[model samples]
Target: MHVPDGFINTPVSVAAGVAAAAAVAVSLRGARRELDERTAPLAGLVAAFIFAVQMLNFPVAAGTSGHLLGGALAAILVGPYTGVLCVSVVLLMQGILFADGGLTALGVNISVMGVVTVVTAYAIFRGLLKVLPPGRRTVTAAAFAGALLSVPAAATAFTGIYALGGTTDVAIGKVFTAMVGVHVLIGIGEAAITAATVGAVIAVRPDLVHGARGLAAPLKLRVDGRLVDAPAAAAPVPAAARSTRKVWATGLVTALVLAGFVSFYASASPDGLEKVAADKGIDQKAEEHAAAGSPLADYSVKDVDDARLSGGLAGVIGVGATVAVGSGIFWTVRRRRTDEPAAAEPSAA
Candidate 1:
């Protein structure tokens, strides 16, 4: 959920800002191990895809809708550290460009939506992957469960933050109950989206999916009444050489369709967090977004009379901006990793 301004006080927001900065710093280092030639490109696509799917909010309850949180999906498709950065990039873009999330609450949104969700989902996913059969299906299942749990976990975290620095005098227990309850429903939707997306990629290019790495169970055959492992095949052509090009092409096209076309059909209802906050009076002190005057505020282009066109253009712009920013970050991380060895050799020499 995009936490707006006035929901959390200044002190808590600043604390969250520090936490978010630390998380990004850690992710930048961790991502070096996660990003390589094959995965570096996909990382950008993952961010853009998350941005696109997030626009298509599905109905969860009478008045509440939910969208893809993308932590588990990104972590599963790429890696946990990179996933945090991916979601953070989307949050930053949405805040500054689309005014979807508040600028003052940027750190809160990043901590809750990016850091909390990625860490929780990745932990559960790794745990499950250790016990389950080493295959794409198991990884997909784990991704689904991880994503489902992460949403509620983030909700609980936000509830705690509100308890500490809430602007209003609402009962903490009620806030917890309401926030957790609605988010649980939202979590189911999140899980399905994560599973389907991860599963699709795993089916096509398991080699490219970071979480699916090392998951290929060797094929065994009986020869002369004895079981023997099949010979490993040559590394199939690089993902870029054989399939990744097509996959990336298809993924980018799909992102465009979802953001530019399908989003128009998405329900106009308030999302889960928004509905909950309003109904429970949690947003009684909610302040207007600083970028409310931005041309793309509220996901609509300024002076665009056509509701469909305005929203479509905004969605397209968001997807493009997210991809550009995400790719730039991932590329820098990848380059840094490459540079480390050269720098180290100079010292050794």
Candidate 2:
């Protein structure tokens, strides 16, 4: 959920800001290991895709709707460290450009949405994959379950944060119940989206999906009366080796279709957090977004009378900007990894 300003007090918000800063710092270092020529490019696409899908909010309850949190999906498609950075990038863009999430509450949103969801979802996903059959189906299933749990986990984190720093005097227990309850329904939608997206990529390019990397089962052969593992095949051609130009073109086109075309049909209802806040008085002290006056505030272009055209243009701009920013960060991380000296080969003697 995009926490607005004044929901949390100054001290707690500042503390969360420090925590968010530390989390990003750690993610940057961890990403060095996660980013590769293949994964680095895919990481940017994952961020752009997340941004696009989040625009399509599905109805969850009578008045509440839910959208892709992207942590679980990103972590499954890429890696957890890079996933954190991905969601953070989307949050940054939405805050600064769209004026959706508040600038003051950026840290809170990152802490609850970015850090908490990625860590929890990745842990559950890895754990399940370890026990389940090593196949694409199992990996996809784990992704679904991981995504289902992550939403409620994030809601729980927010409840705790609010308990400590909530501006209003609402009952902590009631808040927790409502938040987790509504988000549980939202989690179902999250699970379906995560599973479908991860499954689709794994079907075509399992190599690009970090969680599915080692899940491919080895082929077995029957030699005489005994079964033996077949010799592993040589490494497949890299995406860059075959056709970087084509892949980039296809990815950009898909992103444009989703954001520029499909987003026009997204639900207009308030999302899970907004509904809960309004019902539970969490927004009693909520302050206006600093960028409320921005041209793109509320995901509409300034002075655009046509609702469809205004929202469509905003979505396209958002997708383009998110991809650009995400690719730049990931490319930097990948370049840094490449620049580091390789360890000396072991002595043959």
Candidate 3:
């Protein structure tokens, strides 16, 4: 959930900002191993896809709705460190461009939505992968569980933050109960989305899936009432087959359609945090977004009378902008990875 201004006090918000900055700096270095020539560009696509899917909020309860938070999905499709950066990019874009999240609370949103969710989901996913059968199914199952639990975990984190620095005086117990309860329901939707998306990608090009790398291995068999190791499967997939321009183009097209058109049919109800705040009086002190006056504030283009067209255009613009910025950041990181070896060697004598 995107924490808005006036929800958390100045001190906690600043601390969150510092924490967010540090995490991002560390992630940039951590992402290097995960991003190669092929995967670096894919990282941007992952960010763009997350931004698109997040627009399609599904109904969770009578008045509350939830959208794909994308931490687990990103991590499963790419890598954990890159996943954090991907979601953070989306948050920054929403805050400055769409006014979806408050500028003052940017760090809070990044810490809770980006850092907390990615860290928790990735840990659980890796842990589950350890015990489960190594295959596509295991990866999909673990992804579902990781995504399912991360939503409530994020909500719980927000509750704690509120308890410490909530602008309004309220019952921390009630806030925690409501947030955790509804978010648990929301987590079901998150699980479904994460599993389906991860499954689809893992099916088409398992090699492209960073988290599913070690899952597939030599075949095993049972013969003569005894377990036996089968011969190793066919030779490894060629690099040419792994990262094709056609697949990347198809993925980008899919993301564009989801955000630009499909989002129009998404539920209009308030999401988990908004519903909780409205119900529990936690939003009493909520302040207006600083960018409320922006042309594209509230995800609608200024002076666009057609609701569907305005929102669609905004969504498309958001997807494009996110991809561009995310790709730029990842490209820079990839270059760092490329340059390290040359710098490590002695200069020409």
- Please give the CA lDDT of all the candidate structures: 0.90, 0.89, 0.91
lDDT of 1 by residue, 298-327 (tens): 899999999999999999998999998899
Q: Write the per-residue lDDT of candidate 2 for residues 1-349, one digit (tens) a residue.
A: 8999989999999999999999999999999999887778778878888898899989898978899999999888879999999999999999999988879889999999999999999999999988887898999999999999999999999999999999999999989999999999999999999999888877776767889886787768999989899996698665446544455567777877888888888778899889989988989999999999989898899999998899889989998899899999999998887777543446558
**Predicted candidate 3 versus true structure: per-residue lDDT over 1-349, tens digit per residue:** 8889999999999998999999999999999988888888888888999999999999999978999888888887889999999999999999999998889899899889988889889999999999988889999999999999999999999998898899998899999999999999999999999999889988888888888996776556999998788975479666645655766788899999999899999999999999999999999989999999988898889999999999999999999999999999999999999999999999888
The segments of candidate 1 whose C-alpha lies over 4 angstroms from its true place after superposition are 219-231, 234-243, 347-349
Deviation (Å) of 85 in candidate 1: 0.2
| Model 2 residue 160 lDDT score | 93
Against the true structure, candidate 1 reaches a TM-score of: 0.94
Runs of candidate 2 with Cα error greater than 4 angstroms are 219-247, 342-349
Which candidate has the top score in lDDT?
3
Error of model 2, residue 304, in angstroms: 1.4
Candidate structures ordered by TM-score, highest first = 3, 1, 2
Ranking by lDDT: 3, 1, 2
| Superior candidate under lDDT, 1 versus 2 | 1
lDDT-better candidate, 2 vs 3: 3
